[model samples]
Target: MYRIFIKPTLILAAIAFAASFALSHVNKITRGKIEERARQQKEDALKAVLPPYLGYTIVEKNRKATVEGIEFFYSIAQKNEGEKILKAYVFECENPGYSGIVRSIVAVDEKLTLLGMSVIQQAETPGLGARSKEMASNKTFFEVFFGLSRKAASDKEAVSQSWFEAQFTGLDAGKKIGIIKKGEWSAENAALRQELIDHNAVSAITGATITTKAVILSIEKGIAALKHVLEQENNAPGEAASP
Candidate 1:
């Protein structure tokens, strides 16, 4: 009886130990490649956000950046001019969607002007918001935020907050960025609205308005957070001595 029980127990132990060894080996082999790929991917995303005319370099990682008074993690990318900056990409913000988090990489120039933004990940419903990735050239609803220009630093909220949040379009950094009923919008707003509508406005995936809102809010909050950091630095008076 003892011999019979001992044989089965030893077999089970052997199997468990083998499984653990295999898992550890896999992790050790893949860890470095996984980290390298992630870093390269982030660099590619940052390049997408910056204006075509400028160059960029990574400034920091895993730090907070804000938009529209909201905060999120950022990987700052900057363009150099001998020793100065010509453009910058502040943060790549991610927000929860209906199925998973949607990620966006936002870029601003040295003058603190918005350059462009691109979706990194989204699991929105198919045929609706899932089409955001295709909106830029296909006239879909989601492309409105792309190529959004900023005339000044303060204008970041103007473009990201109002129109994009409510799914409005043609908004610049100087616009009010608000929402109204279909007919209540002003002539200018009405014109912008129709343009978006014509663009197909990347229609919400029927039951996924919450996910859409999350994407917009993430961008807004990210911009707001970075703005706060820049403000703090500007007020510090002596922190500029070093990079």
Candidate 2:
């Protein structure tokens, strides 16, 4: 009885060991492939999000700040001919939304004016929080007047809801951004308009107030983190601000 039981247990153990070994081997092989694909996709994403221009070279850099374990990836846009500076950047910030962290990247000129930005990563609720990436309006923000002149009312509608991240273009990072619900069509409230006009305000996503706030907070943090670099570049005695 002892001999029979011992042999059966040994056989079972050997089979289990062999199965685990096979799985580990498969995992290692697949992991390498997955990593390679991820790297390629990241490179593509970084390239796509940059300010669109021809003959500019991107120089990538990663930096970790002492505060809040913030890590950012940045790129310098350099001209091809004389290697002149086209645009400068101070890149990413991770801010917590209702569901999880929202990671964003910014592109700025020498004056630290926000030029372009991309939401590179996010982990949030599907319909509500995720709408941060969408435009406030899928159609024209405000429609064009008489098929000729463009008015602010119609222009507002043109902004992409799916690309809500692009709304930050041309914002001055010096001022704090307040989140508001008012848009071009609705202006009954004077105080909100005053607040928006007085302060650099961003219109929040409908039903996604938390996500909108998260985005604003992330940008604020990003600006804070980039303060030193911006000051050094913009305040240099002999430096001329980029147009």
Task: Identify the candidate with maximal lDDT.
Answer: 2
Model 1, range 108-172, lDDT digits (tens) per residue? 55444456566667887785567554322222334444644333335432332222323422223
RMSD of 2: 9.1
Which stretches in model 1 have alpha-carbon errors above 4 Å? 1-9, 55-87, 110-113, 121-194, 197-208, 239-243
| Model 2 lDDT per residue over 179-235, tens place | 777543223445654565456666676678888788878887877767755556578
Q: List ranges where model 2 is wrong by over 4 Å.
A: 1-26, 54-56, 63-73, 79-86, 134-161, 182-200, 230-243
What overall lDDT, based on C-alpha atoms, would model 1 receive against the true structure? 0.56
Q: How accurate is candidate 2 locally (lDDT)?
A: 0.64
lDDT of each: 0.56, 0.64
Which ten-residue region of model 2 has the weakest summed lDDT? 135-144
